[model samples]
Target: MDKKKVSSWLESELKGYTLKSSQDDFVNFLIKQADKIDKEDHLLLKDLAIDWINSEQKDLTTWGMTIAVEYNIQEATPSIEKLLGKVKEGKLWTLYYLWYIDGFLKRIKEKKE
Candidate 1:
């Protein structure tokens, strides 16, 4: 999986981040990296997603969902679904974030077809 390469790329890409716009490139790059890694590495990607979400960086949070979608990390699906339910129940204020995750989940499901 070349974890070192992924870590190095992420560290370099995330340096001096200023705005969400800058994250687009980073997100795409990470997706490509995930594609190259072994499927068994899904746990690593899942952990990365959780870390980004917990970091509270809005853009990174979106990127995490992107990773989950790209890799089909089923382990994250329950958490994302729960969060979506909370958002729908008005227990969370981040509507856009939840919506994005919900959309990602739908996309993943569609891809399985």
Candidate 2:
């Protein structure tokens, strides 16, 4: 994939900082940038959902959950749900296996809390 193009696309979609970096860096930048958005910019949250959760990079899925946890705590539940859907279907990323498991455990723990 064209990392630069993707980065630029993310920068535009995010609408705050101009993004100019490699795809990995851009992904991190987008995650960090999401923290800067005011709560009023709910659109940015949705953009983050599309960019991070639906990113082609499997690593971004975890990063998306991380950002969702940091920026929107309520989103953590839905993020785990999305990850669980992937795990159940056996399409979960090998690298993110533990992250997904931990998220599931976290959800269960929250329920018992």
lDDT of each: 0.63, 0.56
What is the alpha-carbon lDDT of model 2 when measured against the actual structure? 0.56
Candidate 1: TM-score?
Answer: 0.60
Which residues of candidate 1, in runs, are more than 4 Å off? Answer: 1-12, 15-26, 33-42, 51-57
Local accuracy of candidate 1 as per-residue lDDT tens digits, 1-113: 55556645654565544444766776766666555443557666677765654444566656666777776666666656766777777776567667676787787676656
At residue 13, give the lDDT of candidate 1: 63
Clashing pairs in 2: none
Instruction: Tell me the spans in candidate 2 whose CA falls farther than 4 Å from its real position.
Output: 1-32, 73-76, 95-101, 104-113
Winning model by lDDT? 1
